[model samples]
Target: MILVIDALNKHRFGGILDEMYKLRARVFRDRMGWDVMVRNGREIDLFDQLDPAYIVALDGSYNVVGCNRMLQTTGPHMLSDVFQDILCGEPPLRSATVWENTRFCIDSERLKRPGADRTVSYAACELMAGIAEYAFNSGISDVISVVDPAMDRILKRCDNAPYGYIGKTVQMGKTKALAALSDITEERIARIRAFAGITGEIFLEDDVVADALAESTPVTMPVALRDYCDAQIAGACTDSEREAALALQRELAGMYRSQPSCDA
Candidate 1:
């Protein structure tokens, strides 16, 4: 199935959120045994109310499938509120220039359906691509995702680790580990598509938007924040800090290039 990607305004998102909660309850609570709260067959979190999120993936009839919740680092996120131990100790929470990519999970029952692979992969790729576009356009410098260690291996093999990994491996479950990524890359994206057996181009189709998304335009940042990032990248900071800066910069650049205008 060809996956569709659409940005929902806050009003439209209410429905998506409802669907996502049901899906999450099914996958995490009933299936995976996550010990999460489920009410009327729906799972939710306090952060759900506080964070601005995007829903990804769809079922055969075009219902929501796999979904990932995201929040800017300006707000409390995974590294800050939940997975602080996952960071290998480089200020697990960045003050700025970062976004927390969280709540990435797939609905397995939905996955068992025909053509589910393409739908899931397309949704994942589309969401990542769209996030990259939004980040660059919004002047955000980086996007961060904390994932399981096994998945991190897959991601590293795919060459998607261009942004860098600052988090350490922590047990989410037996055979489940959590790690973090600074950004997404073309090579990594191509690998993920291949892994899911998806074949086709998924770049955005608009040149103006692509250019704005891809290029490193001077965005407004506080002088101290900008200098700190530069200094960290230049090795004036600790090794971990340098790594964080490098990852953040790479993520920002890759996202910028993934825009439709930069596709050429």
Candidate 2:
């Protein structure tokens, strides 16, 4: 349901990511009218180039249904660089243990479809739970996001309410925006799980999922091997070196192509 993508393995899931970006364009630009940048049908900005970790949601058919972006507070981020007004009079938060979570959105159309694997409410809760679990496991002490009052209430209702707030709420676009502070704790995660009736793991390891998919889909390779081969090809300084690197890539491509389909 949830796939955590960082700078490393993102290349392996390019199609899914395109859907996520398009979803962002719809939510932030068309729906919320936040004046976000949408280019070539994908919403992207400077923050995206900073290599922030992205948490993405997928449905039964592997459609990108939800997503969230996380960035270390010690570096450039939305609240610190773009939406600093949310800080009110105080300085922006900067810490190795605190991460700024932004671009939190879900695909309204897809999640509401009939016979979908997850409803919108459950997907949202799962995403929240995934974030909480990821943060707790990563040694992050806190996560912050600039959200409005309605979102605040939703968080509270979902049992993942922010323990504290920073700065004051002010009108940003259609609603008031404020800095929301949430502590990474087991209790919060438990409450979210209880509310959504979600048990077991919320996050799927990217590598493991890729490996499984590779087994089922011929011509698809695991991300690690693909990345290593790509690096070798890019770093080749001579014709022989280039052919050597290309040999492994060609052999694997043929091997994968020869595999019988699961239905077979």
Candidate 3:
């Protein structure tokens, strides 16, 4: 399944975000030999602080298997900020409707079986579908992604090849990288779905998503109190104890509901 997490709701997806970063470190820094930053086992950069949206792919166990980062082209992005050489003298493209995609990687070691080819996995197609669906629904018309030739070939094999190129390929460290633009439309999404044999929505259920957010979020004071209440409720053996725990939970819920809204 796919989960879309943006800046406003990122606090809910902390665990998934950590897994994605560690996966990026494994794929780009360790496997691909990219000169990206890997601090304390996480491959993060300045762009992460810009509050970009992330489309993350999860397996049956809800573990993060793949992810891609999306940033508005009008803001700080890879193509304009770090990959200027890929443009080959051409001006970097920027627009409100166009978004930049970068740091696309999959957890190959965990997701790929012993004899499986990582490029042709279902996780790749699912991640692409998630990106297309999320962007199309969000009023984004185009996405320019910084990718290597291997990714370019994988996209073509999956029948989701880029419609146009931004510039010539340039050598970055040990890999040849270039920019490719893809249209975000229902037709494009449909084509990917057809290839991937996905019939219904690939997103997780609303309740499951909420639970993931609530469980993964960093523990604050309120959260710590809630955890204690939950533990009390779970350990209650006598009927009276259970009733008291339930009443405490209800009181905490009421208190939470009565708090002033931050957005207000």
Candidate 4:
């Protein structure tokens, strides 16, 4: 399943985000030898502070398997700040409808299998589907991705090829990289789905996410019931009375659990 994380709700998905950062550190900094920041096993940069949205793919255990980052082109982005040379003297494209995508990676150690075809990995296709669905839903018309030539070829092989590109491929560290633009539309998403043989929805619903998070944390008692329980405990005059109050509290807790969640 895929989970979309932005600045506003990142706090709600702390564990998943941590896993994503670690995966990025492994893929970009250690394996690819990119000169990106990696502190305490996490690859976080200044753009992360800019409230960029992330599309993350998770396995059955909720471990992050694949991920990608997106930022508004009108604001601080890679093409404008870090990869100005890629533009070859032209001013960086800035628009509300176009977004910059970068930091795309997958957890090869955890998700990859020996002798498995890398060209058609489930995690990779899920990440691509998440990006396309998110962009189409958010009124984004296009995405400009900074990717290496290998990734560029992968995109084409998956039928998600870029419609246009900016500047020639330039050597960045040990690998050659370039910028490619892809349109965000239902047709594009459908094409990816067909290629990946995915028939069902790849994105999890909000209520499903809430259930998963609730299962991980301790259940919180309702404020009024908690206050009543406290009052009962404080005002108890005998051991038997206190026991009765405690039993009532347990009953109330059961009732609360029986009630449907508001998020549901």
What's each prediction's TM-score? 0.59, 0.80, 0.78, 0.78
| lDDT of candidate 3 over 39-156, digit per residue (tens) | 6677878888788989998876677889999999998899999889888888889899999998888887776656443333788899999999999989999999999999999889
Clashes of 3: 0
Per-residue alpha-carbon lDDT of candidate 2 for residues 1-264, written as tens digits (9 for 90 to 100): 889877776666544555677899999888887767776567877787677888888776567889999999998888878777777767888999999988899887887878888889999998898888889989999999777787789899998889899877877766677889999998988999999999887777777665655565547766677666655654444446546766887787788678887788
Q: Which scores greater on TM-score, model 1 or model 2?
A: 2
Q: Rank the candidates by lDDT, best first.
A: 3, 4, 2, 1
lDDT of each: 0.54, 0.79, 0.80, 0.80
Local accuracy of candidate 1 as per-residue lDDT tens digits, 18-104: 567788888766766665667656676656656455535554344566777667677777677776677666666564567777666
Candidate 2 Cα errors over 4 Å, as ranges: 211-264
Per-residue lDDT for 120-214 in model 4, tens only?
Answer: 27678878989999999999999999999999998998889999999877878878789999999999999999998878878876457745654
Q: Which pairs clash inside model 4?
A: none
Each prediction's number of clashing residue pairs: 7, 0, 0, 0
Model 1 lDDT-worst window of ten: 1-10
User: Which candidate number would show the highest TM-score if scored against the true structure?
Assistant: 2
